[model samples]
Target: MDEGPQFSLEDDGAGGNRLVLSGRYLVSTLGRTNQQLRAIDAPVSAVDLAGVTAIDTVGAWVASTLAQRHGAEITGAKERSLRLLEAVKIRESSGSVAPDRLPVWQRVPDHVGAMMRDLLRGMAGVVGFLGQIILAIGSVIRHPSRFRGRALVRQMELVGVSALPIVGLMSFLIGIVIAQQGAVQLAQFGAETLTVNLVGRITLRELGVLMTAIMVAGRSGSAFAAQIGTMKLTEEVDAMRTIGISPVEALVLPRILASVLMMPLLGAYAAVVAIIGGAVIGEVALGIPFLNFLERIKDVVPIHDLWVGMIKAPVFGLIIGLAGCYQGMQVEGDSEQVGKRTTQAVVSAIFMVIVIDAFFAVFFTEIGWS
Candidate 1:
């Protein structure tokens, strides 16, 4: 039977100590020996390993550490044990465990440069993705048979029809808040009735479409990323390609088309619902007749305001759809990536929507749309 590792120290004839090790020095036998070794701090001039019947890398490391601490020479170690000891020594000398630190000024510039590089790469990727979508749209146009009408209809239901209740509820509450607040502010100026104009114009020109876009980005946009990301993870996208189907046309085009087509309608519906909500507040809180408020919307809110919202709606939808599908297609490696990409899609879509809305606001103001 193999014995557990044991160690002892004895004085050399020259008045120095020699540490002697015995028994099997394998990892399985080193538990008590390790504890015992940690407790010893005696000066030693040499380590003798001849009495060890079996040894491994762990044992070699322990012996090497003990010898180095006391500047002791190792003796009676076989060739295999010597090699392990040398390997551990070399690794300890190499600075692989910790990285070198840079000055704060250097690190700050490096971080900023990296961020800029990432931003440029992301912009290039988005441009390339847009080109792919354009090509896919053209292909569907050239070969009408490739168009998946049922898929488009289904996506439309998911992106638009199914979203109505929540969108309506949200827009209604926003409208009430806007009206109540506007009424109070205008009352200070003795122009309380102008709340009707405030609610109509703002909801039609900005809040209605912007809020709806945000909701859709949170809802359908995230869904698109998750669904396609899951499909990618499952290799379903690859299977479609192997069978001669363009994943872009079969998967992406329908979704984009559905969003582009449905957004104007949804935006218009949300605006109408918001106006109705404002009308409710007007009647109950401001003592304005509901019918008169509705009649006033037609006159107080310009036709151009509705046109501005309608114009932005499809663009917002396109942005949301593109962001979602692009992030989904970018998913790779593991299931964890699907969740991360889904979150990225929602964030990117809403960010781009707000950016584009700002640009449109400036452009329309310059062109006298305001």
Candidate 2:
């Protein structure tokens, strides 16, 4: 008769991984059961399975269980050992388990709808802002004395002072680009000298003023929105009303009146810089004499073009200021909300300015005044 498979554990010394298992395993000869598993006494990197000979079904099950509980790094585990482990669902103790299924693609529509909802919320804020402007206008009309001269002047400075550098830079670069493009196309027709005409006419009539307004819309419009939105978020608007002060008189009025007054001046400033820039490019790239460039430019660009551009300035200022103030009133009392509305203010202001420019184009075209 053979003894059942089992083994006694060894004493693990210091500095080794030790494993202790109960019971003996494997039948070697009659009258004595052979050792099946040897207990690891030290830190073991591997277990020797060579000691395992003919394994009963229980022996296979024991091997598989040990492999799963510890590690299956046995040096002598052959196909039989692996097969037995597989049949019993034995796996490495450190093996990673992952989900059997992946998430569905239906999350896409939900994300898109969220984005659209945010856009609509921003638009509603703009509508509320327009209503506030009307209310402010009425209040201002009813109380003209409320217009503090010193504060109004400061407001004008806010709208105009910081705008000059950007206006000059953009207009100068735009003039250079126009001159370069004009020279290229005109050279094909042997009329490269006409770059003076192209630069002067385009800059004075449309580019200079439109570009100035757009810049202001981007810069000042966003400032207005962020400022107002932050105040709204902080409940400053409500505090003013509580103190018997009108937010319009205190905030919207000054900014709007400033924009209405100063953006035209700034536009005029931009136009002068643009013309000067065009003249510089006209002299170099187009090889046109400065004196001739100026003289010829006078004949090409009508003085009325300057007026047309200047007229668009106050309108742009209104759109920009209104958009900013409107967004401010819509602020949801968070930094993120303020930032979002500020961006909306800038985009809407720029969009409105472009729309107004289209109207100018039509008005000029219909009146037979290029």
Q: For every candidate structure, what is the RMSD over all alpha carbons to the true structure, in angstroms?
A: 3.3, 12.6
Candidate 1 segments whose C-alpha is farther than 4 A from its true place: 1-4, 8-19, 36-47, 64-75, 89-98, 103-113
Tens-digit lDDT track of model 2 for 1-370: 4333444344346444433322333322312332234333234434445555555545556655555445534456557755765676654456458745434566677778899998898678667767776887787789888766677788777778877788889988888888888889999999987787788778777888788877877887888888888888788889999999888778888888888888788877776677677778878767777778778877877788877777777888888788887777778846999888888788888898899889988998798767
Best by TM-score: 1
What's the lDDT for all of these models? 0.93, 0.73
Best by lDDT: 1
lDDT of 2: 0.73
**Location of the lowest summed lDDT over 10 successive residues in candidate 1:** 88-97
Ten contiguous residues with the weakest lDDT in model 2:
27-36
lDDT for position 21 in model 1: 93
What's model 2's lDDT at 164?
A: 78
Candidate 2 Cα errors over 4 Å, as ranges: 1-127
**For model 1, how does the per-residue alpha-carbon lDDT over 1-370 read when each residue is reduced to its tens digit?**
9788988999978888999999888888898788888778888999999888888889998998888888889998888777878877633464567778899999999999999999999899889988988998899889999999999999999999999999999999999999999999999999998999999999999999999999999999999999999999999999999999999998898888888898999999999999999999999999999999999999998899999999999999999999999999999999999999999999999999999999999999999999
